[model samples]
Target: MKIGLYFGTFNPIHIGHLIIANHMVEYSDLDQIWMVVTPHNPLKKKDTLLDDYQRLYLVNLATEEYPKIKPSDVEFKLPQPNYTVNTLAYLQDKFRQHDFSLIMGEDNLKSLHKWKNYEVILQNHDIYIYPRVSPEIENLELKNHSKIHIIDAPIVEISSTFIRENIKSKKNIQPLLPCKVWEYIDHNNFYRK
Candidate 1:
């Protein structure tokens, strides 16, 4: 099986995330798209970030109906301050029969070169890039790399930060989130500080 790892904090999973994950699984060769809920680094202050399990639950709620997309808490099990390259290595070791790749936005592609062991990641796995409205230019070296594939997915501008801010302001951000996710957040009064 070909699995695409889509990493994010997903403090609260939203429609934009679902759209991209769905589009990748449907449009690309990936058999599954794992929405890897990134764990918060212990070194950083946990100001606006929700509890790890809460974020994972939100991801689960958001992706439960999608057959091809599922939520993963792999990073939660790994050592803190984990890097993508390490996760890829671990996943590859654990799931030897399956092929793994990355799913990221074009904006992330711009800063790919700065990531730890980025060259190793490029050599070992393919990267699927979704469009994002960003003013920064992508790295010239990676722009034409054979391991990187540009996917013509829809440009979703909605963000978890935006949704959280709206909820805090007592605005109806229902349209931005999945039904179950919205219910969970509303019931729990998340981000309403």
Candidate 2:
């Protein structure tokens, strides 16, 4: 089976995320799009992120309706400062028969060179990149071996940081996240400073 691993710190999974996951399964050959909820990403600022379990729960709520979608907590038990290459390697070993590929935004594609084991990741798996409008993906110095596919998805500018700040300000974040997730966040007073 072709699995697309969409990794993110789903501080709270929002509609924009749902749209992309749906698009990947609806349009691509991918049999499933696993929302690999990362506990800690080595490249990001730690302070701004929500607790790993909370984020995973929100993603689970958001993706529950789609059988093709699964909210994965695979990275939580793994070592902190999680690197993509390591996570990919681990998942590959665990699910030996399944074909795993990376799902990311065009913005990440721009900084592909900086990721741990960039060349190896390129050589081993396919990357399904969705557009991140602000950062237009102009041609980077192309590596000869990588397999990259660009996907045109509805460009939603909603960022987790912005949602967190909005919740902190007691602003209505209902439109940003799914109803179930919003309810959970409100009940738990998540992201409130």
The lDDT leader among the candidates is 1
Candidate 2 lDDT score relative to the true structure? 0.85
Looking at model 1, residue 40 earns an lDDT score of: 90
Looking at model 1, residue 45 earns an lDDT score of 96
Off by over 4 Å in 2: 41-48, 143-146
lDDT scores for all predictions? 0.92, 0.85
Question: Candidate 1 at residue 78, lDDT?
Answer: 95
Q: Which candidate is the best by TM-score?
A: 1
> What does each candidate score in C-alpha RMSD?
1.1, 2.2
- Each prediction's TM-score versus the true structure: 0.97, 0.91
Instruction: Encode model 1's per-residue lDDT on 67-125: one tens digit a residue.
Output: 89999999999997899999999999999999999999988898899999999999999
lDDT of 2 by residue, 1-193 (tens): 9999999888878888899999988898899999998776656777867777878888888988899999899888888878889998998999999999999887888889999998889988999988887645665554233488877777778888888899999898798889999999999887896
Candidate 1, residue 116: CA error in Å? 0.8
CA error at residue 107 for candidate 2, angstroms: 0.8
